[model samples]
Target chain A: MTTIQLPPLPRVAPALTCDPAAISACGADLLAASAQVDDLGTFVAGRARVDDWTGEAATAYHQAIAPTGRRADAMSLALRGVAHRVEEHSAEMQRLLDRRTALEDRQQHLAQQVAHLRAEVATTTEEGAAELQADCDRVAGQVQAYETDLDTWVSDLATEESEMSQAFTRVLGADDVDRIYGGVADPADGPLRDKPGAGASPAEVHAWWAALTAAQRRAVIAAAPGAIGNLDGIPASARHAANTVALGRDLADYAHTEDAGVLTDDERTCYDNALAADEARREIEGRHDPVTGEPIVAQIYIYDPAAFDGDGAVAISAGDLDTADNVAVVVPGFGTDGESAPYQADRAATLYESTRVLDPSATNASLFWIGYDAPDNAPWDEGYDGAGVVTESMAAAGGERLADTIDGLRASREDDPAHLTAIGHSYGSTTTGHGAHDHGLGVDDVVFVGSPGVGGDTDHASDTGVDPDHVWAGSNSRDPIADLGNHGWVHGETVFGAGLGDDPAEDDFGAHRFQAESTTRGGAYSFGDHSKYFDHDTESLANISHIVNGDYDAVQEAEHLHDPFLGPVEDPEYDREPTSPTTSSLTP
Target chain B: MEVVPVSVGEASRAWDEQHLDLDAAATQIADADTSGFTTHVRGAATRFLAQWQRHAEGLGTVSEQRADGLRTTIADYVTSDEATRGDLVALLTYTQEVR
Candidate 1:
């Protein structure tokens, strides 16, 4: 009369009541409302000082409407906060609901198995009953495990709901709104009281930033956006937010001052820089992600409009820097500044697209880092002064900054490092060389394109703090600037050259030189060819893309340049012939 | 005292336009749907929307009031100018008769 005990099957109901689409729609509406309110505030502020409406009444009107504008800003910020939370919650709810559905289906299957075993056990003979009992025990154990999993899932759902409520409470609190978005602190005092200084290491900065409360971070961004926007080790998304706020505020302030005809000379330069940055951001933002079909995310990694004495340092990324499998920093050469951001961003976008085309599954990000004060004039310019281009001072300084930036990237993503590469063009290659040689640029690969020289003292590719095999160079046959580097002469006579450094494309430079012939024009030498390395459908761009995608075997190699007694020689195996003019002194 | 009627009228019209924009923004925020959210989130969203609506409406009310104030001020200024002109004309007429 001994009974075979079985575990009871539990109920398998999953309540998934949230509609993701509706929640997303609500978030969109909230964002629209926020924008509208912002526009209203801007209108009120602009209209406060009407033409020919001066004197006591105008002053009173300005004073009276100022508070309304402040209120509008606060309200808009509050709406944005709630919208962000709601949107995030919607995504989380969808994931949880999916998991719950899977669990419920498993529960149903297990319940059916239990019912079948119970029915068999009731009709089986003694010998058959033992086998049926074994089946029952296995089914009961599975049911018990599923019940445990179900309990854990239920607990997780409850925890998520509770966290969501807390988040909403924090977002909707009135004090938080006024304190965070009210712009209560002075800009000169910096954003947060305890924020790391410029001299702090990236790791220190990252730690300091991670320790702040969410509200505190928002307050800091609102109070001193320029400071936070350019700080290294801050997450790209946060930097983007801070930089965007800074850009808008600066533009508005500059526009107001310009309208009043009181803009200073320095302010005018910064204004142009701001406009350029905005144009660059707009260009990237207008592009659609190939995979997601959504507007591409552009991060303003660096936004210092007044840096480099108004040459203006700026870096804009074509993808998410925080979470990408591969990352490349494209450093432009001479004549680059904030004004060059649009073109640089285009180049970065092209490189990004090329990487995506090469490998569709892998995530990639490309940054147009015009972080240094590049020489305003090229060495090949008609009346080129030897002040900036002929010397390696600018490159060395820029290299230091580049090293810091790369190090910051490493520190920020220490948990999951990316396949980082530095692609330098023209004098940027020199800067990159200096960075790797002098400062140990912590990148997996170094690519020098149309390089005049890597650095003044870097004679070998191995001197660039990377394996000589990993160092790559691409010099268009007709690129005059690429020929500015010194090549070893024949007859056992070492030539003391006046170029920036040893030519990376030379056979003795110990760097892999790739085919970079400019097919756009058939000239013996064209300055335009130097700029064509990054052009689409070009062998040079393809090779660079292969290197960026970490597919080194796919790269097409080219013959290296060698200096002979008669003239500069090239291997006949390569189809393109060297077209650079022969010169005794390679200054340019 | 030296207000230009054209400028005052333009300012008043601008305020009127802004008032409409603010009102529309307030309505948009207040009418945002929270029906798809779970009970706890929906409740929070409703409260937040209601509070933000008040703020927006408050700004809208200020805009409307400013527009009204500007309109009244311009009208009063024009009326005062007209009265002053009439007094000057009457004075000139009375002086001419005396002469």
Candidate 2:
């Protein structure tokens, strides 16, 4: 087995300030200084202007001199007000620096501890190796624990800064603070903030949003875009509008920051994702309809950077989810990101197109969910991540994310409920399977293609939460990567590193198999790759589109494999024959 | 003010990553060839691999019930990408028609 090289974990954020006195003093000083300035900066100007003049000539001189002096005085006051703000910002920066120093000191202490432990281990006898290993593991876990805590501290600091900006805005215009929060009456202690739309139930969210005035709604969209951008139970149009503004503004900011080389690694990733969001936007802008190459209206439901380790979470809909009768969520497999978003978008577009073809009046939207870390990433390998496609840990985690995403989608729907079908391809199938198996994934139907496994102990389609008949599986006969999941064949009882779950196509998995043309090299057991499941002139894509649109009858059944003993089996599709395969590409 | 479970899901991932993180850092324990520190680790891994192998064999019932399904799956395996075959060597040995 080959070993992978890994970099040591490094701390990413400064420690939180424990000096409440200093922080409180800074806040008090900023508030007092800001209050010291009159709202219009007119006091100095009034004091500087002359009251009267004696002669006509003197009057003209006084008139011009008085206005000029008044203007200059106002300008001076404004400059001073700005200078006071600068002072407060500078003070905040110093506090941050102080916190950083503390964090660095702590880190130094840990580093010394690690070095000491290493020295002790170096002289240990063979009998103590196990003890040393345990010690090292404990120390490393501690280091990781520190990094995690630091991230939380960083998150808190960011929140503090946002609140501070709100506070600053209040000082600028207390009367207009309502507008600044996008109609949130009082951002910190207001109806919207008291019960944020994020985690509220659908009815509650809708009710809260409905109670707001139109101007208030617009204000919320402006000031707290993320609040409405990702909140459940909001209209898709509203979310799209909010996200569009946010995307454009953030991308512009990121572009400048990235070009200046001032972005951290996570910030750089966010920058790339912003670009990807723009690319998908362009795709929607370019398309006229789901199938036709023309312009169409759409929504960018969510674009979050704070969560999921900056891999970020995004959902793009080609049609309005609230108005549509059908919604298809396409969960992609390994190596999915903004760079590959356009391709996934294209696939989504095609699914939308297929749904249209299947039914003349079927209103549909297709969404691409690349929200989770799919697997150990590589370029779009025919098999997932090339030689690194050895672990299902990522898929397992992605399953939970997928489950939550589906729940969010359901909660976000407006008007009448839409029939939602989740579709997954390759390792994505495994991710979805686990979602269904573990997370009570709420969906109407599920379809799988080029799946490995979902997770352990999921023996039937019903076990995945969806009805057995509603669970669909499609795999190309010549495809070689499908079996790596080890779902199709027998295995030793003690097999470790199993796929996410049982194969949905397996007879006992109780999934409906649909026909798909082989997208592999013409071979019995040789060199076919994954990724061709969506190729045109194939039955798989046709079946997947049909499933999404609820055109179940239109989905073609797989070819009879002619089981020599059992005649022919139906439901999940299967390959025609087996031949010897070379173990060339799948070594550690 | 509120501390939700941020580490709830991440804790497991961190443990899983130790193979790369801790193993690489403590090459003294991971690289068994010249390192006494790795002896315990190598033995533990072997035990795990062997134990899971037994768990994998419980599929004897599945193989019989879905022989034809397994046949087509095996066919796909033969024709599919060769990159993942070695990973399934144990299954292949267990499921081949002769066996």
Best candidate according to lDDT: 1
Candidate 2 chain A: 10-residue stretch with minimal lDDT: A578-587
Instruction: Judge candidate 1 against the unseen true structure and give its global Cα lDDT, from 0 to 1.
Output: 0.75
The Cα error of candidate 1 at residue A349, in Å, is 0.3
What are the lDDT figures for the candidates, one per model? 0.75, 0.55
Instruction: State, as a TM-score between 0 and 1, how close model 2 is to the true structure.
Output: 0.53
Say which candidate scores most in DockQ: 1
Residue runs of model 1 more than 4 Å from their true location after superposition: A1-191, A378-386, A489-498, A569-574, A577-588, B1-99
- For residues A363-470, what per-residue lDDT tens digits would candidate 2 score against the true structure? 888888777775535546434543334456676777887886676677666446789998888778877887888887778899988776656656678888888889
Q: Tell me chain A's TM-score in each of the predictions.
A: 0.68, 0.61
lDDT of 1 at A65: 78
- Model 2's DockQ? 0.01
Clashing pairs in 1: none
The runs of at least 3 residues in candidate 2 whose Cα sits more than 4 Å from the true structure, single-residue gaps closed, are: A1-191, A197-199, A259-261, A290-294, A305-307, A376-389, A488-494, A518-529, A559-588, B1-99
